[model samples]
Target: MNLKTKLFGEVYQFGSVKEVLAKANEEKSGDKLAGIAAENALERIAAKEVLSQLTIADLRNNPVVDYDEDEVTRVIQDAVNEKIYNEVKNWTIADLREYIIGLDTGDLELKRISRGLTSEVIAGVTKLMSTLDLVHTAKKLEITATCNTTIGKKGTLATRLQPNHTTDDIEGIELSLYEGLSYGMGDAVLGLNPVDDSIDSVSRIYTLFDEVKNKWEIPTQTCVLAHVTTVMECIKRGVPVDLVFQSIAGSQKGNEAFGFNDKIIEEAYELALKEGTAFGPNVMYFETGQGSELSSDAHHGADQLVMEARCYGYAKKYNPYLVNTVVGFIGPEYLYNSKQVIRAGLEDHFMGKLTGISMGVDICHTNHMKTDANDLEILATLLGAAEVNYVIGVPGGDDIMLNYQTPSYQDDATLRSLFNRHPIKEFEEWMEKMGLIENGKYTERFGDASIFFGK
Candidate 1:
């Protein structure tokens, strides 16, 4: 059978299948709607297998021997109360994959958020992932590797490093870091950030690249660098490079909220297109603790408004490879009503020209009281429900290196007693009663308790 037939067969959405295929075939020169619809149909079809593995009945049924139906009903209701909770709890990984595929094609936009840091941040990431076991648990997830480098004044690292540090020095660092990480975790996507604000900086970057061209492997890697005046210099010098666009927010208390000058953004977009570099602008960026409110004077919430306008304008003018938006610095509002915050951001990007958005969940400060694992889980659920792409904050060195240590974990006998309640025990006994065993055992996979209980 053909790809479409197989996908449709999996999803059991055969009726609209022909209509979808017909629409896909009837392509106009620049008709985006048709393309989006076709992509959506394909994703839904692809996700069928994973979705089949889940059932509301399985989740709703209590495993405890003496479980009270009333309590089980309440828990189920609570879980289903939120839109995201409702949509995701029953979704299989394949369903998620379909959603991701649709997101890639712009049928749906997935917003991914990640905290930013200098090269020193990697150590924090290592510690954080170790604590969470995030990578080992995630299956078939795409990991992207990225490195940020800067232009040094005169005799800085960018300019001074020679044969020992090739142009690929930055790339090499990123690869090495990723390799170390994946050895303990899984594979990831690799991207580079070479900051070129001046001719000298660009020259240094190119020189670095020249040293590593061909010697470096990893064909699937993607590059993200800036398109400054130095970009032209690199091109003239015939340096193999990929460009990435970034928006820098101005200082919080400074004269103005900083961002890419409009003309510069446009120029970079045009240049990257001309040179066939895989480039896209980083839309959402803000300083630590700076919330959603766009800065005034120089940086303002209006920046988001302007970014939306510019992205759509560019999409109309030129068919770029990808358009991305980022929603950075999730505030208390995100914690309180993460669903709403994510929904609004996704709506803005979906209504605009963005192909996808990155949702940032930065935890720069080391106040354990302020951020915790539960907070991270809430954010993860919200992102999953929003059906957007997002990045989790891998603890940075500054966060990990802090002298302050969180309080020691305490056992809660009260909580344990609550679980010992007859209803809870009955539920467990019932699961035992049902003989519903996976590999002849019942297991709990989520929550801290499950980790402790071996269930």
Candidate 2:
């Protein structure tokens, strides 16, 4: 495969697919920190030029991590359909880019071609795409998944109710959840990232979620975003878990840093199927971000975007009900500022959909980052326009437990209104039943958690 190009009479060469992918990426602090980023703007453009000419087969032949050494590589490679691969093996990354955004390529054609591509190829084309290119191409793919209810039905925008508490206080958590539900949120799943991961603490929270779901007959799913093993033990002890949650990385070593493996993940999924509450083949919910593999020292010299795409490929193996990137939560060391964060958010959402998973985003930023609520709003609007499956909804856009900021319950409510979208059909019907929404607009009763107090 050719990896040489000239920009303004200067020669630029990349040693491998890994180098080309890294250099072609738009500026990211993590890649710079890794000492792999292109030296200057001209070199970056040169890398993109060379990357666009590389064929799919070039990427397929050069897995970032060897298949023998990495289970993630093995899973992604083993899953490729040889017949589909052959049809597109000769296509350059540039051709794939135009074809994806071409007028003729809709969801059906994208889905069919997606069966042949690997995570590396996905990352390759992503490097050549503009910010708006990412958004427009993602608009054509409407991926969905089901657990208790379906998400991504074209007119629906769902949310994961993150009623987090710094102390894991039951009353505080319940109060936040009640407030969120009052705002017509939590249709995707009522999930909490608990301060405590002990089985008793998790069990108590799960019991509370179960009691509330039954008492109100709310048509939604519930989960406690604790460690996979903690939730596994909870399931064995009969805690009602609607979804099994895990924060996965693109590589096996990064997953090891998270203290689990494919074996552990597979076992957890099997246990959820046999003993958990959700009725579905899609039983897993995974959260990923750009810098995770690099943070864990498991990036294998690949850039964050390539590693991020590998996440979706790895996630597709289990047919997860939910797969979201907590985009800006990794901080400025990876994404830097608002411009970088927004770009990563769009790229992640598009790559996830292209990988054929139910894609959502936690359009978030840490305190130290050069971003604020306005940047979050901009990205959320773009994601809403792209018809994302869901986004994380926390009280006031601040995650007290995780100490980060994401979309608020009220922000998501406004997003639905702005986009002319509704929650999952069953949850919207439940909202109507509770008098929170009327004729697709909020009623006077909305935003009042007290309605649930007397009941």
Candidate 3:
């Protein structure tokens, strides 16, 4: 079978990719059973392999190649297909890299093609060696969480001002948003995963943020990851909802862990569409992670990474504006340490990006794991380099309610500076106008701290 990926609009025919993942996840799933899944998987893997082949040297060298991205993609595909059919094993990463240098692609398509090509390489290679399969929920991962940037939005390093509001106190919630935003955290959206799921609490949240957004003239979207039922009621009551939020698992039972079913998911997605969005055409924002299936005993014998990628397939049904893969937030049971965290971050990012979801990474860790801020920093910067759409820019990189550390506001600034990235265009302009940022950098590291303290 064939399908066009979301971002690059590349058509892919996978053959080995699905089989490798399935075989890795479930030792019994063979090529015959993989069928269409393998074909889909192969396309993504080939894209990554092809992307890895194109080097800066190749670009800088102006190698004797013409600009034919499609042909370059097809060459990589042909080699991968041959391998998937067990016809050859001659094409290595080195061979593919050298081959890509000969392609004639334009500057615009180079990054897009390169990004699409580079995404799925990690997970495919892991299958040849030791598979990073899921383990039993040996230990409980801290469940303090959390997208609503915009659909079809590009050229911006986006982030959500994610603040966990445990209580229904409007003032407390406002302060969190204000603080995070003051620090340049609210670049694309102000999304909150509320602990209080009460109807009144959820309703108050929509009202509070909407009022705050207007009063403060913050040009961004907002979402509350509440029950679809509550959000639907809020919609019925004429409350604003910029994006629909849900936690989905690859396996059915895993979704049951969060009290979600496909019917409810579809209903919420459809309902949000009626409410309209502040940004692009999409109204859904889904959050996913590895180990949710295994942790909830819903993996259905698929490898965790495969299961994670499968969740993106589910998200695509709604055409989400943002799909965030919280790589390390699930704890160490699935991803042991920083190295595992970094690898998972890359794997999650590539899978999401390859699948064509405007992807982001949390790259965070709870106290339960053997990780620190530095580990998250590495993943964040790497994701930044990968041209991911958004990240979680928390205050001080610490989420008090979730008990985890994400890249802080300053880290976002540092990445933006390093990559020469700007926030969502209108947001960048607003920040510069408001003095929250200066010359595309944050105005205050502590985020207008003196104002919060009345200094």
TM-score for all models, in order of appearance = 0.36, 0.99, 0.70
lDDT assessment of candidate 2: 0.92
The residue-by-residue lDDT of candidate 2 on 287-321, one tens digit each, is 99999999989999999999999999999999999
Off by over 4 Å in 2: none
- The ten-residue window of minimal lDDT in model 3 covers 135-144
Report model 1's TM-score to 2 decimal places. 0.36
Steric collisions counted per model: 46, 0, 10
Residue-wise C-alpha lDDT for candidate 3, range 1-455, written one tens digit per residue: 12123335655432333332443332212222323223344454544443333332222122111224222222223322222323213334344333333334332432333333321232333333221221101001111111233322434677788877556467878888877777767765688888888777887888888897888777788888886677778887788777777777765567778786767877877777666445446777788887777777665444576567657645655667778888877777776678778767766765565444567778788888878888888777776666667788777778877778888877887887787777777777777776767665556533684453546
Query: 2 or 3: which has the higher TM-score?
Result: 2
RMSD for each of the candidates: 22.8, 1.0, 12.3
| TM-score rank order | 2, 3, 1
